[model samples]
Target: MAGIGHITQDWEPVVIRKKAPNAAAKKDEKAVNAARRSGAEIETLKKSTAGTNKAASSSTSLNTRKLDEETENLSHDRVPTELKKAIMQARMDKKLTQSQLAQMINEKPQVIQEYESGKAIPNQQIITKLERTLGAKLRGKK
Candidate 1:
């Protein structure tokens, strides 16, 4: 029996150093600056955000801190027990694996596993898809 490591092929990595054209870099810089000026998709981190009062908006700082806290403190308990049980029972009734159930709903199997195992909470759209595919209501009832 051979392990995956033993089955590996010979390989070589190459390092090439090339200076990018100045015009393209300048064009990109101008485009990024325009976007930042227009308040488009990018957020710029300045050289001195740490322990500095130079930042204009206190609300931005507060919102960023709140977002960080919310992300770090997510709860598995947010997944409803009723929804979990309903998905499980329906899958069993149909004699379907989690992968099969996910396929029927046009989702990935890992998504089904995540919701069923209470590691994640489904949104309204996902709940609707589950209800339709599983033939069970995930909302608006006991």
Candidate 2:
């Protein structure tokens, strides 16, 4: 940046960014009609194995199982709101989804969701993992 401003070159002190050119220009009707591409060739999806659907179907079952397990082991105690907020923020800042974060912490995604939603209080082991995995502290200062 030059300290001295020059009027001859039409120089401004502040830098302005030119917006990228857009598609606002009118397209020719002939060109527009030509660009419209469609074909009579119908492409059909490949027939998948029965196992493909089995894999898809299993996910729902696994989810239900996890939900059932979480319900059974619901945290009777309430976790501190601040700690939950911290965990949620840290997890988000680290760009880790609940499932991904849970995988890193060796816990289920339901656990992470539960902790964030205040549906379940994390145990000490889970807390330690959370702190280590997220590079955050679920525990308060001693």
Candidate 3:
């Protein structure tokens, strides 16, 4: 009994102390918050893109666009046919074939063909080249 007396145990609740937040820990928390915000922003951007694509897809069809293209073709056909003749004459005067002229101008031969055939019109830059190379004045130029 004297050597091994019963030890009285205090069953008091043990409180665990958490470490105080330091400046580095606060910085880490801020980085985590920034990452979460960035993730949310990315999700929002993806949703917006999906919505826009859906709206665009729903609005138009190929058949309607084709009809519009047909009207455009009709209007193009009405452009005076003399421009085509001028382009062809210019090429002939230069002793240049369509492919040769296209090479000189850095355009495709088909582009020259389109201009000569009056299927597609050339803009002012080409008009200048046509005049210079062909030595002929366009119908409406001064």
Candidate 4:
């Protein structure tokens, strides 16, 4: 066998590289230049189109009184005058004020006032309450 000092050694080569340029920076510069050109065109157009007012006017006017009359005619479902008279007479016979009777029926005083004045829309629940409190037939078939 040969001695260890006579052995040969092998080595690998090393490489150097250069960096590539960024693609996004070139796209951003092109977009900024295009925006500047469009902005100048918009400013010139705005100056040329200034102070020309186009006011829109209508010829027809609404008749509110006619509408009111139509609505009043259509809404005919109200408390009858007879029912109002009965309610007022019964309340008077019992010596009860409108507020007192409203309390007895667990209702607001305005409800009693509306019923007496014939302005309230007929509600059977309220009518029954009034009948029970006043000991009278206030609804249906006399």
Candidate 5:
């Protein structure tokens, strides 16, 4: 009889051992937990601050209700009065006569007088020019 060779077979099923959790995996879990906690704390702080600020601001505004209009007036009062005063002041401060100011703005001296006297309303372009000349804010509208 001729010699024959037999193939070897794995009798036991190949087993894969479960891997132990790596250091990186543990670090990732810790970082995720810390981030969640920090987010929660930030939200809580914002809510608390918003509530107090809202209450404080509302109360302060309520207390100053009487002075609101007056403050607005001081800031820049009447449509006509403020514009007139601002123009005059700017002219005087610059030591420029009404005629000079008019020349600078390309208008007649009478036109400047009319504007200051509230006999006529200056257009936006003129007012802007006056504002620039006077270094003060002129009235836009009420």
Candidate 6:
């Protein structure tokens, strides 16, 4: 066998490089800075507008007057006092507690309490249930 010849290979060393920012990146940076400044100005304008709105609202009582008139015109239909009394009387005659009456009518005890206190909005379904369970005429004439 012939003597092995020495092999020599030239290899360049690996080099990592960071690229310089391009024109597009510079333009993007400028756009971001402009947006930030405009955003701050927008926030200040919003605050100023809010302050002006509060001042304008104090000067204008039209909205407040309208709200008051609307509230005055809106009438809540609560359970009548006579119906409340009838419910209470019927429950007492049946010797049923409020919770017992509520259970019989498939309602919460608070419902019975509200009815008795005349705070409940008139619900036809609940009235029907109560009438059926109590055998009392809670609604309609007489």
Output candidate 1 Cα RMSD.
Answer: 20.3
Candidate 3 residue pairs in backbone clash = none
Better of 2 and 5 by lDDT: 2
Query: How many steric overlaps are in each model, in order?
Result: 0, 0, 0, 0, 0, 0
Q: Against the unseen true structure, what C-alpha lDDT does each candidate score? A: 0.78, 0.78, 0.71, 0.81, 0.74, 0.84
TM of each candidate vs. truth: 0.47, 0.45, 0.43, 0.49, 0.41, 0.52
Model 3 C-alpha lDDT per residue in residues 14-124, reported as the tens digit of each score: 899998667566458575587587784322224556536776665577767767778433444422577877677767877899999888777788878888777775577
* Descending-lDDT candidate ranking: 6, 4, 1, 2, 5, 3
- What is the lDDT for 126 in model 5? 78
Per-model root-mean-square deviation over C-alphas: 20.3, 20.5, 17.0, 15.0, 16.0, 10.2
**lDDT (10s digit) by residue, model 4, range 1-142:** 7565777777877777756436564347675577577783322224543465322222222455556557444565789988999999899999999999999999999999999998999998999999999999877586
True-structure lDDT of candidate 5? 0.74
Candidate 2 or 4, higher TM-score? Answer: 4
Query: Can you list the residue pairs that collide in candidate 5?
Result: none
Candidate with maximal TM-score: 6
The superposed Cα distance between candidate 1 and the true structure at residue 91, in angstroms, equals: 0.9
Which regions of candidate 1 are displaced past 4 Å?
1-77, 140-142
In candidate 2, what are the lDDT values of residues 1-142, reduced to their tens digit?
A: 6887865766659888977535532244553444455422433356566436776676699888878778455436877798789999999899989999999988899999989988785588898889998887678785
Stretches off by above 4 angstroms in model 6 are 1-73
lDDT of 2: 0.78
lDDT of 6 by residue, 1-142 (tens): 4688887899999999989657576457575587587783312224556535677676568878877778455667999888999999989999999999998877899999999999999998998998999998988685
